[model samples]
Target: MMMNKMREIYGVVNMILFPEDEDPEMLSLELFSSFAKAKERSEEIIKEFIDDYGEDYIEHVTKKNPVAVMGNGDVTGYVYIVKTHAL
Candidate 1:
């Protein structure tokens, strides 16, 4: 008998701001097998946004969703950090 193994996947969600548009663009930027790497990438993105627009213009959002099963039978639930304009 063989047992199935479960693993966690980490991802970053980016909200790109447009000066001319009222709505920001949202998308998944990257995926990682380790949370540390995902978090580092999120920080990098935040820093870039701050460097370009200033801290007052950037907002951080976090969301946690329920676990989802992929088509290949891999289960994943993401806790993502998003960068967007300050509201």
Candidate 2:
């Protein structure tokens, strides 16, 4: 079978093209807040995740918009929730 290779590039990436079988899914929770507050909450969530899991599981860059925050379509910052378990 052919393997899917991942590459890192600079600038904004529109999509993640990881294969499903190769990329196992994990449970996560994300909280969105204003740009001014995103980092604070991200740090808090990271601490909580470490307390519960005994380690860090934040897959992407912290305090960045890894996923779109969909609500009223307003552009807001996000804090990605990390955990140790998969569901």
Model 2 misses residue 5 by how many Å? 49
Model number with the top TM-score: 1
Error of 2 at 11 (Å): 33
Question: How far is each candidate from the true structure, as Cα RMSD in Å?
Answer: 17.8, 16.9
Report the alpha-carbon TM-score of model 2 versus the true structure.
0.28
Worst 10 residues of 2 by lDDT: 23-32
Worst 10 residues of 1 by lDDT: 4-13
Q: Quantify all predictions' global Cα lDDT against the true fold.
A: 0.45, 0.44
lDDT of 1 by residue, 1-87 (tens): 122121111111112334343322112212323566878898998798779877754432333333455655665544454444676
TM-score of each: 0.31, 0.28
Give lDDT tens digits, candidate 2, residues 1-87: 122112212111212443332321111111222543888887998688678656533444344445656667875755454333475
| Candidate 1 Cα RMSD after full superposition onto the native fold (Å) | 17.8
